[model samples]
Target: MTTITTSAPAIGPLSTSTIAPANPRAPSRKSGIAAASLIRLSGLFAVAAGLVYAGIQPIHPADVLASVTTQSWAVIISLKLAMCLAFLVGIAGIYARQAGRAGWLGLAGFVVFGLSWFLQSGFVFTELFILPPLASIAPQFVDGFLGIVNGHPTELTTGPMAAAYSVVGLLYLVGGILMGVSTVRAGVLPRAPSVLLALAALVTPAAAMLPHALQRFAAVPVGVAFVWLGIALLLELGRSRA
Candidate 1:
């Protein structure tokens, strides 16, 4: 007869619980890299949005009700819808990148600007979908809406749209100035673009008063600033990785 003793294996041989060791840092590391990549991608989106914005302005038609049915109007407004969506994403990345240094002003500007984009998004959607069908169904109403947009007089009654338009413009003006000034104070992005952002916001009302042909040019400065900031962000990201 022989006495036999059995105990658990030293390495806990091939059981479910002991097969592998958990890595505490791997998940965090992966998440961090993923976030950084998202930021980088947003920089690219910003550049694309800037280009689209500038490109569309040249072709953007007047706010006449007749333009609503035309192919050109549809195309231009479709582009605008895209621009608003992309800009919203890009701006979030922009703010996140500099948040630490951006301080209270940056926070305020980001919130305000973000809100403006949200409003713009809703308006663009209405323009893209509702306005087209409504153009034929309710011509006068559409005309009045366009009037609210262009500051023209219309016989038709359009409630609250004028006020909404003014609110959107005001938010944009204030937000851009705050963001620009904060960027300048933070000294994170290029100075020229930051300064241009502020200047463009300031001149918007004057530009809006210009004839349609000339009004489009007002977008140039803002577009240029967007492009420059996007480029700067990409460059900064690249340097960090290196």
Candidate 2:
């Protein structure tokens, strides 16, 4: 019956946690939120670019030289400049977001499409600034350019620019077709918009064949696709954020 006094075992200080008690990487939330916000901004750009690009088509004057001299022509050219710029930015984000899933065909299409847009800016700039001034002084040259635009024969040779015009149209046609097809295959966006994008390219030639009154209608599909894609992008973001 001896008194057994057992000294309580010495308790050392609790190990200091190198990690935060709640979460070590909690700061990352801000970064993620910031990224999502930037990407969402791009979606808005796409919507605007698409709208202006497609909307202006119906109003676009015929591919006649006289059309270039009008004030409305100037306005249309300015709008095209803005649309091309926005397209350059918006499509970049669209392709980037889906790059991983889109694969090589997507990459090729993106590069070709982006290049086409880049080249198109130069054409638009010339139209807005250079061509208009020469419209009066160089009527023949301007008429030649107009002929080149509408796939008609010209009385005067357009030199390198004629070749460039052909190249740009071809690039736009091929690039849009490729991009639309790739986007469809990527499965990132809704199928309807993607299909319309492809269809828009396909119908463009046919649209050109249409009466001048209906030529503008060709742009409707592309415009619709653009708006749809923007809405889709925004909705997707909302879902992800939720």
Candidate 3:
């Protein structure tokens, strides 16, 4: 008797498709590193946004002083601090994924960058926020404070405060260069974004030292580049998820 036997279609190799976990963990260390790199890129963009705002409008000494005395300055300074903190955290994440002692250099570079931002921003904030109040109380303090506010007081500019900012600017330039190089060499990030970041690092020192008229144009390119890098990072992250 010929019996008609019904049989299920054979599944080839059991299809890893069916066995795969619903929420599969990232398969490779590279993926985790890439994710962390993307986070750092995003944080850098946040800091860049705050800087862009600071750059776009002219904050004269008087205006800065006024803003500091008011609650508005507090908000702005607070945002700046937040941005720096986010950047440091992102750096930490990136450092965690590194293989060997190289991570220490990366961490050091980021630390320097963070410290530079603190010093530079602190100088400005103090000149604007603290000095104004002090000047208000004592007319004698006005001249010293004004010099700092104008960013051109012969006494203060040539004194410890200016030296501090100068050191900060130098550290920023140097640390940025080092970090950019390290990032590129690490191979975790895309080449183009890394190149742009390195270029941004180079531009910062020039902008800080050069006359306003000459340096003003640099901001446009730097800002645009940072925004582009951020968008690219976001796209890459989305692609990895997909």
Candidate 4:
């Protein structure tokens, strides 16, 4: 009697909220993964190109020159240049993960390695193309240049180019060793490939300096080392998907 029964609140229809449908056409996790895979593939191709040019250096200098003049060398050189660019991208990826001074150093080292390739290729063009054409017509030009320094104007075999090659080779050798070490230390790549790259770095200089008698044998190790590095990179590309 003292309290009127409170009217129960009327139950209303259950509120229905509309949820936005995910766009099926939009890129998904899988698409992102695929894009990353493509980038890695490009990097692998670049490394392979660099190795091919490195291998050709010891095998057939004359043929390498002919190939370059005829534009065949462009294929490999372009590949190598692509590799350098890819390597810089890779280094950027590394920096994204690590975010430190080491990333900058690694990038610098990669740039040096890339520049060394350009230097080696340019040296070949000048010595094999420009100088030879000039010398062909101007032995007097060669002699004047050589004799001014008390050197003889001999045919530009590996001898004349050897010094330049050694310089470029040394740059690559040092740059490679640095980058390989950084890659291994940063865990950006597999240890095996990094180790193989380091070994290849050492081998180039050894092949360059080894007594002529032992160069043939020394070169075998260098070639094997590069092939091994390439295989390791390929394996890395496969493994990164998971």
lDDT of 1 by residue, 151-219 (tens): 774766455777777889899899989988999988888889989988998899899878767877888
Better of 2 and 3 by TM-score: 2
Model 2 over residues 1-242: C-alpha lDDT tens digits?
88978565544554343333877476798877887777677788889889997788767877677888899999888999998888877777677767888898888877877788889899788778877889889978777776766666475846787888767767777777887898899999888888888788777777777766677777778778877887787788878999
TM-score of each: 0.86, 0.81, 0.59, 0.53
lDDT, ranked from best to worst: 1, 2, 3, 4
User: In candidate 4, how many Å is residue 145 off?
Assistant: 11
Off by over 4 Å in 4: 1-35, 54-58, 61-102, 127-132, 139-167, 203-208, 211-229, 239-242
lDDT of 3: 0.56
For model 4, residues 116-138, the per-residue Cα lDDT tens digits are: 76675564344334544555565
TM-score for candidate 3: 0.59
True-structure RMSD, every candidate: 3.9, 6.0, 9.0, 8.6
Candidate 3 lDDT, 1-242, residue by residue in tens: 99877565557878555676655565676687676566656646544653553454343223333444556555655555555555444444444434244476667766776676667666655654565576556544445544553455555336776566568768767776666666677766555655665677788765756755454455454344445445545565567666
lDDT of each: 0.84, 0.79, 0.56, 0.52
Q: Poorest 10 consecutive residues of model 1 by lDDT?
A: 8-17
lDDT preference between candidates 1 and 4, better one: 1
Better of 1 and 3 by lDDT: 1
49 Cα displacement, candidate 4 (Å):
2.5
Alpha-carbon shift of residue 64 in model 3 (angstroms): 7.0
